[model samples]
Target: MTYFPAADRYREMIYRRAGRSGLKLPAISLGLWHNFGDSRPADRQRAIVRRAFDLGVTHFDLANNYGPPPGSAETNFGAILGTDLKHHRDELVISSKAGYTMWDGPYGDWGSRKYLVASLDQSLRRMGLDYVDVFYHHRPDPETPLEETMTALDAIVRSGKALYVGISNYRSEQAAQAADLLRELGTPLLIHQPSYSMLNRWIEHDRLLDTLEAAGAGCIAFSPLQQGLLTDRYLTGIPEDSRIRTSVFLDESALDNQTLARLHTLDDIAKRRGQSLAQMALAWALRDERMTSLIIGASSVEQLENNVAALGRLGFDQSELDEIDATVLDL
Candidate 1:
């Protein structure tokens, strides 16, 4: 294929308000959490990104610790930017984060001033960008002072290193505190990235959704497929090429009898809805207006296209919703 984007790429996807911010993100955003590593063919990765843009997916999410070898994802993405997406930079919303281990001991990671500042610098260098659209404190750091972390983020925004600030994996209480601190520094929180899916409903119980919406912060859900557990790929058996078969994050033990039974039940419901399990899962995640977008990571362009098709089948009748609740809400 010659790689020309869709004929009407700009009109293919819908944009939603990213909280109270002036920013608008596509209903689905591409995430470099996996598959954009140095080991993969750079040409293929570039093609995936180009295809996404052509399909109206402008928001691309990244993190400092995302590659199999660490930082290689950003380095590979940097190469892609210099090659394919360079001229179309203004149309893209690129984001990166720090707060996990990226280098050697002590100053290498977490929410410390030294860590956040240095990590953003390295991320910028790796992505070949003067500034990221959104910069995130990847997680809450209990040991580090909240003020120090917010200060580094403030400096990053003030110095034009990043246009907006966000946080990921914070509870309702922690998020409220962080938002208040950032407001004092003149950077109101913009978004919160959380791992939400049909199977994983921690945020619902914790009231984090209400908290973020109350604070006027938007949310983008990560791992909305529940690491593929909510997908049809596991309905039969775990394929060796599947993430569960290879991932340290998703182990073989995760596919116990009970888990498989639950998946089958949900699969049946998805079939009744005329969609795949993965599609149903994504639709469920995006059903909430508080959900700005579903941050999806795809290993191939086909996966990306398949996931985006869910946008067409987003509606759920009351009976379908009730049935889904009965099937997946065991906790």
Candidate 2:
């Protein structure tokens, strides 16, 4: 069957400028970190991508080693692009990252020029892309010079392999340093990807958000649901098919008595606000105007639609925020 996108795809989604960059990303971007690999059915992955686009999600985030087998997610996404989204390429903001353990060799990982360049080339080949809209360094490399990594990213943009550059999992000081180097190279840092959610608020405490604001860079929060902990799926108890039960990223031990109690409190607050726990979690992440988008992963179209619906109710008054702070922050 041919895939025809929804005619009014852009009507409902809210777009925000990525920092001072001219690029505007949807408030919710789709991430291919999970369920878009060989382990999942190809039809299911395609459906999720199609549904996300139909809901006006223009940005698709990926990394060099996102799959269990490594690189399979990009290959799968490439197939979807070739078949379903090839014509709509101009409407998309595709991103991929390097700096993690992608291959096994000594030069296979980290922020070295050799590694970043080779990894991105492999990523482009796997995703069948001429150039990704945003390419990121997946993490900071302590051994490698920051200048080396930022220079590599600048070279990638100058060579037309990536339209813009970003960093992920970098601390406040590191992000500031990278932003300064990129500015010197005439390729200002566009965004930063960080793990942020009710359960995980390191960005607020560490002042990374302040750094990005000072640098004029946007922020996209990953793991805004804390690997499903913020969702209702864990309200009663962990389901058999939950990520905590199956994936290493989340652990059953994280559902401690105190955390579970806090989750219930948050759930109650969500209900009062006319939203599901998951929807409230997303809305909370987007409550800060400094946050450009939230990167969400969906296994099914229904899940994608439900998550996108979070956009409908993004407001949080002072009282609601105070309650959330008492529940999540005070915990």
Candidate 3:
């Protein structure tokens, strides 16, 4: 089928600058972490990607180790880009990260310049692109010198392999250090990607946004739905098709009785506000203006629509916020 994006995409999605950078990203971005693997149907993946672009979602986030087989997500996404989105390359913001273990050998993993460079080359080949709009370090490497990782990212930008560089899962102090090093190299940290949601709030405790704001970098949150714990799908119990049952990332014990009670109470609150728990979770994550965007994963077009529709009601009354603060998990 011939794919033509909707003309009103720009009008539908609101864009925000990444820190003080000249680039702007849509408020909601799509993640290819779980659903773009080779195990999933190709047509369904294409449908989800196409629908996301039609709804004004211009950013698609990926990583070298996203798929079950490690590199299949980038391969699958590349296929879509070559066919459906071939001419729309300039209209999209594509990002991929390296740092996780893609192969067994020591050189195949971590933030060493050798790994970062080779991994991105493989990624560009997989995506069939000359360069990604944004390239990320994926996660902080424990053993690698901070200077080595930041310089690798800077070198990537200079080589025209990535337009901007970012870091993920970094704490406040680590982010600040990376920002300082990148600044010295003249490629300021563009953004930070971290886990944030009603249930998972480590970024708040670390004041990561404060670090990014101080560094003039933007922030994008991942796992805003808390691995399906914040959605109505788990209110009664885990469905057969739920990630808890089908995937290894989430443990089945996470849906224990106490957690189910918390989920129900949260659902009640969302219903009073005329939104589903998933929608409320997303809106809650984006309530702070400092949160530049969120990356959500969807297995179907309907799920993508439900997640993107959250933008229609991003604001929360003080009382609603207070109620949320009082009711949410202490974590």
TM-score of 2: 0.99
How much is 209 displaced in model 3, in angstroms? Answer: 0.6
Question: Model-by-model lDDT, in order?
Answer: 0.90, 0.94, 0.92
Estimate the overall C-alpha local distance difference test score of candidate 2: 0.94
Which stretches in model 3 have alpha-carbon errors above 4 Å?
Answer: none
Q: What is the C-alpha lDDT profile of model 2 across 104-134, one tens digit per residue? A: 8899998999999999999999989999999
> Candidate 2 at 57: error in angstroms?
0.3
When 1 and 2 are scored with lDDT, the better candidate is: 2
Looking at model 2, report the run of 10 residues with the lowest lDDT sum.
322-331
Q: Between the candidate structures 2 and 3, which one is better when assessed by TM-score?
A: 2
- Please tell me which predicted candidate would have the highest lDDT against the true structure: 2
Worst lDDT run of 10 residues, candidate 1, spans 1-10
Cα lDDT of model 3 by residue, 66-165, tens digit: 8867999999999999999999999999999998899888889989999999999999999999999999998999999999999999999999999999
lDDT of model 2, residue 122 = 96
Query: Which residue pairs show backbone clashes in model 1?
Result: none
In model 3, what is the error at residue 197, expressed in angstroms?
A: 0.6
After the best TM-score superposition of candidate 2, give how far the Cα of residue 318 lies from its true spot, in angstroms.
Answer: 0.8
